[model samples]
Target: MKTARLCAGLMAVLVLTVSGCSAADQAQNPSPTSAAALTSCPATPLQAPAGNGQAPQGPPMNELKVPVDTSTSKVIDPAGAKQIQCGRTQLKTTDDVAYSTATLANGTAKPLHLDIQVPAGDSAKPLVVYVPGGGFSSANRKQTLNLRTFVAESGYVVASIEYRVQPDGATYADGLADIKAAVSYLRTNAATYGINPDKVALWGESAGGYLASMAGVTDTDPKSRVQAVIDKFGASDISKLMADYGPQIEQGFANSPNPIGQYITGSPAKSLAASPEAVTAANPVTHADAGDPPLLIFHGDNDRVISPSQTLLLHNAMTKAGATSTRYVVHGADHGDLAFIGDPNAVSPWSTEPVVSAMVDFLKATLS
Candidate 1:
């Protein structure tokens, strides 16, 4: 009954199609009754045919006329020419990769790991080793992974590496060694990770910044020396922290549990007071020379943790030593704040804004 009702309704809506055949031919090749062929009514609505194959000559262009030359398009000669275009780069990530096993201060074995973000291709890419900030204690490599992913997608391989922190009975020197080891590991395995060992960069935030600077300035190992260094509001001189900020800053970090305390005999004040041997060893400015790579330094004007003066100190040292250095002061940015990146955290892959854009531009200029 439903089928009959549906067909009856369709029959009312279905228009007759034109058939240009003789009546005798129509009797021999009759259309099939839909009831005998299709069990269900068709879902598509009927469309009227445009017209029969015929045209009527009506009006002519009697009054309007225009004169113009015939146009010709020249064929572009692209023969034997090589054109290159960069495609949208995708990322491949590997986490918890042990880059090195180091003997700690207690003579115990400790493994350092790195989380890598590589563009998904076989083409060799310049590398960026990202060091995170925990003053000098934390070891979380993926702390700012969203930004690392953004960098990888921009056509570089980024490795967020682990180093000895305060709890590991490690100081900046130990951490620097670990960072260099990580670099050596990545460079040796460059083919596996699709990276250009010759073109490498050290990028870090806070204490990580300090380490990156140290690695760039103090060392010249072909395997670990970086082509560029980007320091984000990292401390430059621990011995002068008291004079730089104030003597009161010393009282706050008077204990060993503090980030700087475990790395050296001084939390910060002891180094500020006596300028300890450990402090001098950790300071990048102490080893600044013309041999240093180009550095891109960013500091927030309102940073309360590590003063913006630190950036100035490093930049001045680099300049005095005849090394290339560029500095940008981000207004209203606090220590390790998103303001340093010139973007917000409400995103997956971070945006290429004033900060990211500056970094990429510097990398291309220096590395390329």
Candidate 2:
């Protein structure tokens, strides 16, 4: 059996930054109205990491610093909120981390759920909201339980959320809306959950990675804005995806009629809304701007489901806009399996230790 290659040399070209976009540049290219929908709530300023130099390397699973006691602070009640709930049955995980499932939002089609995992002994820790990849047609919260546990054991709270899926008659906007709602709900109930709202980060794989990219770029109120984003092999441009792989997508799902079409066409209105000229509007790169959060992108060069160019396009746009960004290309890796089994032919291998370690390190540095 061949062990997975780290491609450490490829990691060297990851971090790329350019001059920040000026006010004049922004004035010339105003943000889309849809992207501006979430700006009503002002976000708290991001906390500066202690000592501006390189963060000291610590143990792989060090405990996070405990937050200030908020027992006496005015606690905002979230029990009655339609979009928020707590005190649910705990889910089982591979580790001893404590976890609970909460309904973040009640959608018209179905309720959106969030599986929240916390470290053994910490309060008010930074948060990592994970979006699972299922091509917008299936929810993978349960499928990613181990990954969530790994993050929780590293002393951060992990919330793996369920958004509306296209097969269930959800449009891309509906899914995106649910994710934004989850972020808002998490921030609103931060005091109750002992989460540092200001330090929230977003992580997702495949389709979920695409959603994370959109969430990071789309304009939203401060409360829902993420400080950092980790996108693992996500499709950033829907139009490009259709253009490049329409034939393959059609053939792959031949038994099931128009899977891609169903995903892109959630509702007749939304389909009509995306005019020919605005076809790429839903693409994450369309919303890239200077105000976007820092991004860490991972893509497999051999990925066939979604081409590596999708990640490259988003990274290029982000760099041009002067946002902090990094891209790591995995050689010989295809889609989601490369991060774990190394062999794309493996049958559901769960050994994603290396990928998990890289993500944990990035989270620690960004959310610390």
List where candidate 2 sits over 4 angstroms from the true fold: 1-109, 242-257, 267-275, 338-353
Pairs in clash, predicted candidate 2: 38-220, 38-221, 39-221, 43-222, 124-194
Candidate 1's clash total is 0
* lDDT of the candidates, in the order given: 0.62, 0.56
Best by lDDT: 1
lDDT by residue for model 2 (55-156), tens: 222111111122212222212222222111111223233222122233322433354577776655545889898887766657656544445655666777
Clashes of 2: 5
User: Which 10 successive residues of model 1 have the least lDDT summed?
Assistant: 13-22
Q: Write the per-residue lDDT of candidate 1 for residues 22-97, one digit (tens) a residue.
A: 1221123212443232211111122233377332211111111111111211112222222111224556778899
Give lDDT for model 1. Answer: 0.62
Candidate 1 to native Cα RMSD, angstroms? 27.4
Candidate 2 lDDT for residue 248: 36
